[model samples]
Structure formats: structure tokens, C-alpha cells
Target: MKQKTIYLIRHGETDYNRQGVVQGSGVDSDLNAMGQAQALAFYQAYQHIPFSKVYTSKLRRTRQSVQCFIEAGIPHESYEGLNEISWGAREGKMPNNFDNEYYSTLIKNWAAGHTDYPTEDGESPDQVAQRQKPVIDLLLSRADENPILICMHGRAIRILLSWLMDESLATMDMYEHSNLCLYKLQYDYDTRRFTIEVANDSTHLLALVMHH
Candidate 1:
């Protein structure tokens, strides 16, 4: 029996993130300065992990968050299935604005256990999980290539983990995912099961965000 390990990370923060704007799959943003520092800090901490491959969403933020590893000559690929859930009409809206009724409602509803509820023209939690199925399938198929790193979006990361853990998407929010935080999963080929080894760890980035 073979064992495989996966290191999962969420992309660092972007300008939209700092501005409290909704940036679902509809918006493609780059990592801000602090985000870059976070990414670098993450890399320096885990540089010895001996990852054979890197996987990222087909989005700039995810790519930029792991740019350090890419530049270091690690082989990587992008998967469209790993993109964030779409926010549709609310893509660029600020969270606290006076007129953003639907956005607020959506958040409240999602938190209130309406995970299947969708904003107008957007994706529901179920839909996001549906699309993410392929990425999961691909990872399972490549279990022989152990110790791969995946950089993706926040919401998408939660969805993927839920699927792997055989848990409900509603429970996914129980996990915290700060920028550059890592989640590690171990797959046992013999039983064809995955176990969570680490969840939402950011200890490696303490120095980067500490108050001076």
C-alpha cells in the first residue's frame, strides 16, 4: 500500500479582500503586498517539504500566491475546477454598502444552513461542490505522485475539504482559512481513504503579520 500527502493552501489576500469586496470567480485579483509577504513566509517555512508537484486554480491570485515555488522551478499546473464560487451580480460589491441587500441576504442565508441557496446567476454551495468533483477525481488518480501542493481560493478550499472528509458542506465553515494557511491530508492507498493531518495552520507566517 502506498500513502500520499497533499498540502493545501488558500491564496493570499488581494486588494478586494482588504476592501471588503465580494470577489467570487467573477473577479480575478492579484496578491497585495502583505499577501506577497505571507506567501513568501509560507514558502520559507515549508521549503523542505519536498513537494513533487504544485496545483493551482486557473486564477491569478492562486498563481501569484505560489509564485515563489514556481520560480524555484517546481512543476505546477492549473485546474479550472478549483476556481472560487461565482458571486454573479454581487461580484464587486462592498459588503457594508447601504444598497447591497441581496449580498447581505445571501450571506445570512448561507450561514443559516441554506447552503444550496444561490445568488442571482451565481453558484450555490452544491454547484461549487459539483464542479470541484473533477479536481478530486484527478487527485485520486494521481495518488502515486504523493506530497503535492495545491493553492486555491477560500470558499473552494472549504468545499474540497468537505468532499474529502465525507462531511456536509454546511460544516465546512467550521474550519478557518486565513491567507497562506495550510491544510494537509494523507491518503492511504490500501483503504482508499483520506485523513486530515493538519487544518488551517498559519504558524509559519507569524512574523509576517505581527505588529511592530
Candidate 2:
């Protein structure tokens, strides 16, 4: 039986992230210094793995997080389907009482299994899943890219994991994540099933000293 392993992680932090600003799919931002350090730590720890390919969201933050692996000559590709869910008008906003209240309500809606609920001028969880399905199917079919490394954003990673783990979209928050956190998974081609080998692991960043 052919099997594939996926090393999936959230991109490192950005200035927007540090400042509590929303950076949805629409906001293309760079990694901050602390983020660069986190990336280096991850790379130093796992650089020896025989990763055949590197996959990331089209976002710069995602690409920058795994830049080390790409620089090491691992084939890399980015896909829009892997981008973070767009927050529409709130893409660059900082949290205030008003926005925070909106977000709280939004979160509650999602938690209540309203996966179809979307932010104003943005995408719903279901819509994000629809866009993601084709890309995931296409990547999984590529037998040549086994044991690939994937870098993405927080909400997007959770959504991807929900379906990959065969759970309802409402259960995605159970797969908690932080900047540079990892979730390793294994897929069995014959059985068409995926197993979670690791979940929300960030041990590699334990020694990361945040300067700033």
C-alpha cells in the first residue's frame, strides 16, 4: 500500500500578527523578526528529513516561514486555495470592542455548526472548503511528492485538518494551533484514510527567545 506523510505547519508570526491585526487572504504581509527566528528553529530541528516537496499558501508569510527548506533545494509551490480565510472589510483592522464583539459573535456562530456563515464580503467555511478540495485532491494524487512539507495560516490549517480528519467543520477549533505549530499526518492511498501522527505540536519553538 502506498502511503504519504505530510508535515503541515502554520506560518510564522508577522508584524500584523504581533499587533493583533487581522491579515486574511487579502493581506499579503511579511514575517517579522521573531517569526524568522522561529522558522530557523524549525528548520534547524527538522532539516535532515527527506522532504520531497514544499507546499505553501500563496501568502508571503507562509513562504517565508519555510524559506529555509526551499533554499535547501526542495521543490516548492504555492496555491491560492491554501490561503487564509478572507475577513473582507476587516482584513487590516486591529481589535477594538466593536470588532472584538463581531469576532466573538462570528466565533460563536461557527461553534454552533454554522459553517456556512461568512464575514461580510468574505468567504464561508464551506466556500473555503470547496476551493481547497481540488487542490488537496490534486496534491494527494501526485505520487512523486511524498512526505511533502506544507506551510499555511491558522484558520486555514484548522479547516483543512477538520476535513482531513473526517470531522465536521464545526470541530475544527479542536485542532488548536499557534505560529509555527505543526500537525503531522499520514495518508494511506489504498484505504483512502488519513491518520494524525501529531497535533498542534510546537516543541521546536521552546527555546525561541522573542526579542522585541
Candidate 3:
């Protein structure tokens, strides 16, 4: 049976992330200095993996997160379907008391299984999952691309893993992640099944701790 290895990671942190501001697909923020360090730490650790291809969301932060791999001349592609969920009116809003309350309520709703709920003019979990289909299909359709490296957003990763693992959307939060964290999965073509090898592993970032 043919098997493929998947290395999935969330994009590095951005100023919006540091400032406690919301950054959605529309924000298009860049990574901050610490975020860059984290990226380098990850690349230095995993560059030997010989990734057959690299994938990232259309968002700048995601591409920046994997810039080292791309710079190494690895084939790379960006897909809008992998972009972050839109926070709509809240996108880029600095977290104030009201915004904090709003986010709490939003999380509450989602936890209650209202996964289809969206912020005003924003995207729902279900909507993001729908759009992510093609990129996933493209990755799976290629036999030559093994050990793929994919970089995307946090919430989007949570949602993506929910369906990919056949878990209910309500439990997506179980897939906790941090900037540059990696989730490893194995896909078996013969059984048509996916098995998780690692979840939210960030041990690669230990190098950064030594740096400081």
C-alpha cells in the first residue's frame, strides 16, 4: 500500500497576533521578528525531511512561515482555500472589552455546535471547510508529491483536521496549535485512511529558547 506523509503547520505569529488584534483572511498581515525566528527554528530542524512539495495559504504570514523551504527551491503553491477564516467587522479590531465579550460569545456559540455561525460578513467553520476541499484534493491526487509540507492558519487548521479526521466539527478545538506547530499525518492509499502521527508538536521551537 502506498502511503504519504503530511506535515501541516500553522503560520507564524504576526503583529496582529502580538497586539491582541484580530487578523482574518482580509488583514493580510506579515510576520513579526519573533515569528521569523520561529520559522527559522522550524526550518533548521526539518529541512532534511526532503519535502516533495510545499503548500501554503494565500496569506502572507503563511508563506512567510515556510519561506526557508520555498527558498530552498522546493516546489510551492498557495491556495486561497487555505486562507484564514474571515473575522469580518472584527478583523484587525484591537481587543477591547467589547471585542473580548464578542469573541467569548462567538466561541460559546461554536462550542455549542453552531459551527455554521459566522460573524457579520465573515465565514463560518463549514464555509472554510468547503473551500479547503480542492486544495486537499489536489494534494491527494498527486502520487509524486510525498511528504508534503502545508502551512496555513490556526482556526483553519482546527477546522480542516475535524473533517480530515472524521471528527465532528464541534470537537475541532481538540486540535490545539501554536505558531509553527506541526501536525503529522499518514495517508494510506490502499485503505483510504488517515492516521495522525503527531498533533501540535512544537519541540522544534526549543532552539529558540536556547537562543534567548
Candidate 4:
């Protein structure tokens, strides 16, 4: 059976990420200094791979994170469907005392099988899954024999992975994704099963990290 491979990449760190703020689709920020280096490392690592196509979210963070790859001559596309879920009112605000509690409750609800429990002005995990599925399906359908590289936000990537792997969002949360990390998935066209070949690989960023 022929298998299609998808390489999922998390966007490089942003200023909000460095400050520990909740930054959703509400604000579009560029990559921080560390992020730029990380992106360069990622590009260098995968420059040898023969990627069929490269995809990224419409957000600047994801765009800037993958700029190195594009500059290196890789063909790329951007999709709003790949954008991160809106944090709404919480956008750039630091969480209030009750906000953390509320967020925890929401996660609990989701883990308990409630996919519709959304934040006051934010999206639920299920909603994100719904929005991201079509784009991913389109990619999978078009490139059944080619490998694709996708650059997207952390939360969006997690939601997409959960839907693709048929796992609960909570389970998907157990894994951590660093800036410019790479994850690879192989999907079997015959069995309709997707297997992870690699997850959260940051070895490419090691040299840069050690030096800086």
C-alpha cells in the first residue's frame, strides 16, 4: 500500500510566547530573535528533503517562521483554515485569577468528553478540529504519493493532530511542541490509518541554542 507523509511544523516562538501570554488569532506577531534562529535551523535541516508542497497559516508568526524555507526556494501556500483559534477577549491579556480556574474547568470538561465547552469568547477544541479538518483533508487527498510540509500554530496543530489520529484533545495536549519543531506522519491509503513517524524533533535547533 502507498503511504502519504505529512510533516507538521510548529511556528517559531513569538514575543507573546516569550512573555507567557495567551496570544490567539486576535493578534498577529512576528517571530522573536530566538524564533528567527530556530526557523533558519529548521530550513537547514530539511533543505535536502524533496517536499511536494509547503503550507502555512495566514498568521504572521507562522509565515515568518517558515520564511527561511521559502527563501531557500521551496514552493509554499497559505490558508486561513490553518490559523490558530481565536482567544477573543483574552487575546493579549494575562490571565486573571479566575481566568486560570475557568480555563482549567474547560480543559476538564473537554477531557470528560465535552467538546462543546468553549471559552467566553474563544473557540473550543472541537471547533478548531472542524475548521482544520477540511484543509488537512484537501492536502491529504491531493498528495497521496508526495510528502507535504505544514507550518502552523501550536494550538491549531494540536487540534489537527487529534482529529487526524482519532485521539482526544486532552491526549494530544500531553505532547509538547517547541519552536520550529518537526513532526512527521505517514498515512496509509488502504487502511486509512495515520502513523506518526516523528514527533517534536528539535535536534536541528540544538547547535543554535547552544551557541546563543
TM-score result, candidate 1: 0.92
lDDT of each: 0.86, 0.92, 0.91, 0.83
Error of 3 at 58 (Å): 0.5
* Clashes per model (N, Cα, C within 3 A): 0, 0, 0, 0
Residue-wise C-alpha lDDT for candidate 2, range 1-212, written one tens digit per residue: 89999999999999999999999999999999989999999999999999999999999999999999999999999999999999888998888999999988988898899999998789888888888999899889897788899999999888999998888999888889999999999999999999999998999998875433
lDDT string, candidate 1, 61-180, tens digits:
999988989999899999888999888877887765553777667667877778899867889988998988888788878866778999998888887787778887877777779888
lDDT of 4 by residue, 85-172 (tens): 8877778887788878877887788778786777678888788888888887888788543788899988787777887888877665
Candidate 4 stretches greater than 4 Å from native: none
List all candidate RMSDs to the true structure. 1.8, 1.3, 1.0, 1.5
Model 1, clash count? 0
List the candidates' TM-scores in order.
Answer: 0.92, 0.97, 0.97, 0.93
Deviation in angstroms for 84 in model 1? 0.6
The candidate, 3 or 4, that scores higher on lDDT is: 3
